[model samples]
Target: MAENMFLFWGSGSIPCWKPMIVLEEKGFGGYKNKFITFSNKEHKGEDVLKLNPRGQVPTFKDGDIVVNESNAICEYLECTYKDKGTQLIPTDKAKRARVLQRMHEAAANMQQKLVLDLLYYFFQTKEEDRKEEEVAKKVEAAIEELDRWEAYLGETKAFVAGPDFSMADVWFYPIIAQSIRMGLDLGKFPNMKAYYDKVTARPSVQKSWPPHWKEEPPMISPFKGRI
Candidate 1:
């Protein structure tokens, strides 16, 4: 059924991981996928450029239909095959709202604001250009945000939005897992650690696990303090 569906993705990319998980959940686990190496700049090649001008993986093609963004691809799969496998988006109105809220919250806050913010301090800045004091302040702000999520998970003890593993968990599990892989210190946030463990154990997550991560571990933390 997913024969014409093709995905150009990068290994260990959190955004790239999302749609793969969605495809697996939607019973399209056998969809054609080619890994694009980031270091090799393959994403910028003509294949990806034709589908995604931004040169990003998760340049997905469903027959002639193209969806570039990871979250949008996941949404497309869920909407296209709502009844095939897992019901990612909940049916209940309030529950659906919660799922959507958490999904985008995870995207904007944890993934972009917190994770990428710290990553910029490391990958984007030269050591000679480092500002210790400024980076420390950013780390503190990130810790406070993590604490809010920790409190939420500690209170709920199920999924990000509720008991059921819905689209919110699909959207969120990778943030927590990838954050830990990138050295967020699951030890600092025990509740989030538990949440990560719970979701990581799910079949969809395990099935779609980044192929590269198995062979090479992600860069570890130089900053381990919880702040």
Candidate 2:
């Protein structure tokens, strides 16, 4: 079958993985996925730059319509292909609102504070030169925020938003998986750990797992010593 869409993506990128998971859940298995490498700055090359001036991965094209940003692409797919495959956005009004709320929280709060802040400490600082106090506080704050999500999961007893798999799971899974790559202890959050096992067991998530991660060692957290 001919591809209905084209996805420009980078391996192991949380943002890029979002739409890919959506596509998988949508079961558009024949769609094209063009892998770009940050090492060679391939995303910055002419083709991708023309599609997305920012030259970011997760640049999506379905015929003449192009979309950027992970969440936007997921939303577009959910709306555009709603009748075809798995329904990512819930049909019930209250459930839909909950999914959307968690989606935004995943991006605005969890991704921003937990993922990016720790990444800044890791990539931007050398071990010998690291500031112990400041990094420790950031790590602690991230864990505290994560614990809140853990509590939510324990209460909800199903997926991120509720009993069904929804956009909230799509948004939450990648960041948490990447944090696992960075050595965030899911063991500290039992409900989150159980949730992790359930999500990772999904065929879509397994298919979308970062290719490079299988070949690489778990990243040593920059706050390893402090924590």
Q: Candidate 2 on 146-169: residue-level lDDT in tens?
A: 888998898799888888888899
User: Model 2 clash tally?
Assistant: 0
Residue 150 error, candidate 1, Å: 1.2
lDDT of 1 by residue, 1-227 (tens): 78989999998888888898989888888899888899999999998999899999999999999999999999998898888998999888998998899888887887765668876567678778878887888787788778878887877788888878888877778866766666677777778877788788878889889888889866645345533
Winner by TM-score: 2
C-alpha local distance difference test of each model: 0.82, 0.85
Candidate closest to the true structure, highest lDDT? 2
Candidate 2 displacement at residue 148 in angstroms: 0.5
**TM-score for each predicted model, relative to the true structure:** 0.93, 0.94
